[model samples]
Target: MMAFSSVTEPLRAANRVGGKEPYSWHLISADGEPVSSSSGFALLPDFAITSSPELSHVFVVASIGVRPDRNAPRAIRVEASSRSIPHRPR
Candidate 1:
């Protein structure tokens, strides 16, 4: 949540200063639903992993204790890998 807010808040601040909305974000989940954060707070997604929404970049915010299979369903992750979606595991 901090990572999301960190990036977004700055973009929003920039927009406020520049007078034009230049940055936006779309929260995505594996199943097109809400995902619970590390703090157990649910975050509603704007799209699903399979939706293939047009994007300049995709940031999979995996934190400590976040399992890969949970962040993204294994099958969907494999499918996305087959399509060559860029992702780096930390």
Candidate 2:
């Protein structure tokens, strides 16, 4: 999951309803470091893409105009392709 969206909080809140729903979520970033949102809030990712396991679903969330360049370092491409993750630009 990404840090800039309210999706995480809503999901967490829903889980508190107390059912059989399983909440297995992880926050990740490009450099395995903390990222600052456009709103100036900061969050640390749980893992870096390169070190993460091959996930069935991967979501890359970035604000509009904040998308990473396609010509970014090879490491980013490798990680994206390795997991078949979709690049959701904004």
Candidate 3:
């Protein structure tokens, strides 16, 4: 939860203080459902992996430690990759 806040708050603050939405964000999830945090807070995602738009940045914020053997996350990545969304420019 803290990590997600740490990353998002800055962008939020920038938009607030700058009086312009220089940074925009969307929460994309594998199922387009609410995701629970490490502390158990649920965050409703804006789009599903398959329904997300072409994103300028994608930040995977996982507060919990995930074992490499976990296949669910990997499956989500695979589903997301099937989209024709172009990669963000470097």
Candidate 4:
């Protein structure tokens, strides 16, 4: 997604310029499969939440065009939300 890339580009560029990789990131989706953005471009996630490594920060990017299935229960989301993960201060 454009917003996702825009948010991370500066961090990545800084790593490049500094040559020390001070920042790194991962793209994650509800499942491990690739997800499409509002513009229909798909991005493959590095890992699913179930299998992700320890994280320092979490950022959520959403699109107004996408809507959840009202009839179905979101089991994975519910389970992920129940976890008590702590975030590192910036």
The TM-score of candidate 2 is 0.64
Tens digits of per-residue lDDT for model 2, 1-90 = 244446667667778876655655677776688777767678788887688765666555677456464533566778777777676685
Candidates 1 and 3: which is better by TM-score? 3
Angstrom error at residue 10, model 2: 2.5
| Colliding residue pairs in candidate 2 | none
lDDT for residue 73 in candidate 4, whole number 0-100: 32
Of 2 and 4, the candidate ahead on lDDT is 4
Off by over 4 Å in 2: 1-5, 64-76, 84-90
lDDT of each: 0.74, 0.66, 0.75, 0.73
Poorest stretch of ten by lDDT in candidate 3? 66-75
Q: Model 4, poorest ten-residue lDDT window?
A: 71-80
Predict model 3's lDDT versus the native: 0.75
Candidate 1 residue-wise lDDT, 1-90, digit = tens: 776677678888999999998777788777788887788888998887777576776666755687566545685667567678676687
TM-scores, all candidates, are 0.72, 0.64, 0.74, 0.73
Model 3 Cα lDDT, one tens digit per residue, 1-90: 898888899999999999999898888776687877767788999997777787766787776673343645675657656764354555
Candidate 3 colliding pairs: none
Q: For all candidates, what are the clash counts?
A: 0, 0, 0, 0
Model 1 backbone overlap count? 0
Candidate topping TM-score? 3
Question: After superposing candidate 1, which stretches have Cα over 4 Å from the reference?
Answer: 70-90
> Which candidate leads the pack in lDDT?
3
Greater-TM-score candidate between 2 and 4: 4
